[model samples]
Target: MATRLELALLSARGVGKGIRLLEYVGLVIVLAATLLAGGHEVWRMFSSGKVGISDLLLLFMYLEMVSMVETYWRMGKLPVRMPLYIAMVGIARHLMADSSYHDPWLMIAGAGAIVLLAVGVFIVRYGHLRFPYTQASEEATDRE
Candidate 1:
């Protein structure tokens, strides 16, 4: 027979396992979707016989998504900058594909957003380098 504390710990462990399982399932779904989208994009380009810059950028975004998922799956952690990089790519793609040249303010806003995201990525990388996380904190962060 286990003590109350032991039972509680066991329950917590089970919950943790369930959460991790869900995480894995979610990752798989995301990976599958990304791959499917990328393949469709490639097929579209081949069928049309024209690969535009926007199409390439869209593919690149898919690749980044795949890489982000892979990194998280393998490392059990995610760098904060990965999503920022993806966002920057997405914004650039949008700006290129649907250039709002007539609306100079909108174009400026999109460019500003990319610049802000880049700055965020730089700050995160710099922080990780200058004030690296300790083993314990990193593990804590992974748990969260």
Candidate 2:
């Protein structure tokens, strides 16, 4: 029975390792694709003479995506505030690009929302850095 339990444990560890390997490979593939797409977009922007605020904002979004991928690759984890920061930037860019198309009140509201999101992202990032979760032996064993 003890041998059987050991075998099962070993099998589980093997499966976990395999899964982690696959995740790493997938992340690499995704990062490559994002880079290609961003490059293509930048080329198109340069070739076209009608560059606008929205186009610049899209580039910024692509940059954020790359940054997020790099952060994950380096730390083996994703930061929670990255997407929020991206969203805030996206909204602000949209407002800037389409200022004449929208009503004044709507534009003001959108800008206000972006400010609120930026504040929230700041708080979350600060808290995460200040109160990081440490992996002690008991917590590690509990996870196992």
Candidate 3:
């Protein structure tokens, strides 16, 4: 039984190592892709001579995505609000860029959705700051 437990522990450690390796590889790939995409967008912005607020907003979204990836790589976790904030920016950009092409009602609905998502992100961020969670290792011991 002890040998079996040892083997299981070894397997778990091996799997954890494998996962960490894979995560690092994935992070590298994502970072490279993000840089390439950002460069392309900047080139387009300079060449087109038609950059607008929406273009800037899209760039901000890309920046946020890269930041989120870096944050996860550094901390092994991502803030839940990051992606939500990105999504809100993306939706706002889409609406601003193509508002005239869609029905007014649809535009209103999309804007409303963006507002709701932004509010949710704000609430989550506030809650997290106000009431941070205890680390799992810290929780293992009771305070005197």
Question: Which candidate has the top score in lDDT?
Answer: 1
Which parts of model 3 are misplaced by more than 4 Å?
99-102, 137-144
- Model 3's alpha-carbon lDDT is 0.86
Arrange candidates, best TM-score first: 1, 3, 2
- Give the per-residue lDDT of model 1 (tens digit) for 1-144: 899999999999999999889999999999999999999999999999999988998998899999999999998778889889889988888888785643889889999999999999889989989998899997897667
Writing each residue's lDDT as its tens digit, candidate 2 over 68-136 gives 988888887787899898998888887878756399888988888888988898899899789877779
Query: CA lDDT of each candidate?
Result: 0.90, 0.84, 0.86
TM-score for each model: 0.93, 0.79, 0.85
Per-candidate Cα RMSD to the true structure, in Å, reads: 1.5, 2.9, 4.0
lDDT of 2: 0.84
lDDT of 2 at 48: 87
Scanning candidate 2 in windows of ten residues, the lowest lDDT window is 135-144
lDDT of 3 by residue, 1-144 (tens): 469889998998898889889998998898888889888999999999888998899889889988998999998777899989998988888888885738888898888998899899889989989987778644663221
Q: Report the number of backbone clashes for model 3.
A: 0
